[model samples]
Target: MIVADGLEKTFWHRPNAKGVLGSFRALFSGVGSAKKAVESVSFAIEEGEFVGYLGPNGAGKSTTIKMLVGILHPSAGSVEVAGMSPQLQRREVAKKIGVVFGQRTQLWWDLPVRDSFEILQAMYQVDEKQYALAMERYDDLLELGSFINTPVRKLSLGQRMRADLAAALLHDPAILFLDEPTIGLDVVAKERIRGFLKEINRVERKTILLTTHDMDDIAELCQRIIVINHGKLVMDGSLSALREQIGLPTTCTVQFASTPQIQQIRGIERIETNGMQVQVFYDKRTISTPVILDEISKWGDPLDITLAEPEIEELIRRIY
Candidate 1:
């Protein structure tokens, strides 16, 4: 559904100085220096696939998305979405994709939520039957009926987000581009959006490409992850495979009744203790749960235990 070949984007940023003299210099010299934000990156996403694009701040993630969505032209290489070049047929491509930018709202602030959808229905040239269905479906999935008559600016953050999502899907696009759809949202709000996305991808067979800093979003929603760093493609694979490649450790924290200084157990690779709690790192392949539990019991009275998988951000940190 999406293909990018050797895609690249360079941005020229002018140095900013304090005074009018600096402004004059910038005027004469134009952009002071240039930096490559995306370089020789290429990948293909299949139809109905949920792919996560992950990177740190200013790590070319947004640059790649912009090029793929035709928001920004690439300096090098080619992009094709749904068999059409985004550069050549932006209008046609736009109709086939639903975009949700978490940091920005595409709806009119002063208008009622329904008005925004009405405007999009006209712009997308959707028929009354399709429009009514879209509204009914979004209202059902997003629970937008409560605030459908309210002005967009008066809605809560979560409500606004839901409304924006509904607006994006009004035309029933085949591909979805979600750029941090869960940002600044509480747990409940995030789960609501995630469930909606999962349903769209599963039930509707829509291709989805999601970019977010939240590891949980990626972990819960994406089966494949594409990692980028320093303007280059670093890793792209399944979440489990990426974790194995990066050597991200699984943490096992156990609380003991008393502090016990101890040597390494048969399965424990590393051990650290603070007060009455013991933290251990072990390879799941090398150590079974029964063995670890037996070793922990030998130390002292066991109070509690919690096992955690490494988050995506931690994995990215290790990769970079």
Candidate 2:
């Protein structure tokens, strides 16, 4: 549904001059430093796919999204949405895509949420039946009815985000672009939004492109991941593939009744101990958790045990 082939975006920064005359001279000089925000990044997202675009700050994720949405034109290469060039067919591409930026809202700040939806419905030229259906579906999924009549400026951040998601989907676009959709939200609010997104992707088959720093969001929502660093594509594959590439170890922390003698075990990478507690690290691919637990039992009587899988953050750190 989305294709970015050798996509590149460069931003030029002009040096500031000390005086007005110098500034004017510098402006016309056409001499400035060029920074490539996105360089030769390539990826394709299929229809109904939930792809996570990941990178550290200044990693060119937002630049790529802007190019895909036709908000910013690419300096080099090309991007297509729904088999149409977004830059050349911006209006048609806009009709096929819905975008939600967490820090910005498309609604009128002083207007009620319902009014905002109505305005968007008109802008998208949605029919009455489709608008009603969208409202009903989003209301059920997003719980927008409670704050539907509330002014946007009066709503809380979570409420405003929910409203924004509803507004974006009101036209029933085939593709969704979400930039940090759950940022600054509490645990409950984030989960609510995640659930709503999951439902829509599953039942309605909406193609979603999500850019988020929250590892939990990637773990729970995205089926594929594309990682970028220094304006270049770093990795693109499934979550499991990323984990395997990084070879992140599984951890088992055990609280023993007394300190036990640590011994080398096959598949066990290393062991650390503090007082009565022992921490074991092992590659889960080489051995099972049950086997590790069983081996630990031979040394001492355990009081408590906790096992943790490698986190998505750790995997991403490895990529960066």
Candidate 3:
């Protein structure tokens, strides 16, 4: 549903200086530096796909998102949303897309949350029947009725976020661009948003491109990932394939009654003994889980065991 080819963005700004005159002199002298926030990035996201656009700070993630949403024009490439060029046809593109930036709300600041929804409904020119259905669906999914009468500015962060989500979806857009949608939310609030996104993608066939620092968001919500660093594409594939490309080790933490002299096993990347616990990192592709369990049984009587996959950050860091 989204296509980007050789997409890039560059910002020209004067270098920092001690004073205004120094900055002015640098600017007038044509000495400003051009920083390429995104360079030659290319990727395609299909309909109903949830893709994570992941990277560290200053890694061009937001720049790429802005370009895709038509908030910023690209410097050297093209992007199309649902077969329409977002830059050339932003109004139509906006009609098909919904956006949520976690740090900001699109809702009117001083209006009641219900008023904001009404305003959006009118602005979108939604049919009365369709609007009613949308409101009913979102009120059930997002619990908007609880805070509908509250002012947007008076709602808590989580409440405001949920209200914003409802507002965004009131028009029944088919695509969503979520930039850190769970930022600053508590565990419960984050999970609520995650579940909502997953359901929206699965049941409604919505295409979502999410940019988040929280690895949990990527792990739980995204089916595929596109990682970038320093304005370049690093990885783009399934979550498992990305992890395998990075060679992330699967960990098994086993607790025994006592430490044992566990002989080294092939395919075991590393092993550590902490009193009554044995921590093992292994290559799952090389050795099966049964093999690891058997080896651990032989080492000592395992009282407890837990397995874990590598964190998303670990896989993203591989590009560095």
- Backbone clash count, each prediction separately: 0, 0, 0
Off by over 4 Å in 2: 255-261, 285-291, 301-305
lDDT of 3: 0.90
- Candidate 3 C-alpha error for residue 239, in Å: 1.7
Residues forming the 10-long window of minimal summed lDDT in candidate 3: 311-320
Off by over 4 Å in 3: 16-29, 257-261
Question: Which ten contiguous residues of candidate 1 have the minimum total lDDT?
Answer: 260-269
**Which candidate has the highest TM-score of all?**
2
Tens digits of per-residue lDDT for model 3, 1-320: 99999999999987777788887888788877789999999999999999999888999999998999899999999999989999999999989999999999999999999899989989889888998999898888888888899888899899999998888888999899999899999999999989898889999999999999998999899999898999999889998998788778899999898877688998889998888888899988899889999988998788899999888777777665
lDDT tens string, model 1, 102-129?
9999899999998988999999999999
Q: After superposition, how far is residue 31 of candidate 3 from its true place, in Å?
A: 3.2
- The residue pairs found clashing in candidate 1 are none
Quality of model 1 by C-alpha lDDT: 0.90
Off by over 4 Å in 1: 16-31, 252-263, 272-279, 285-307
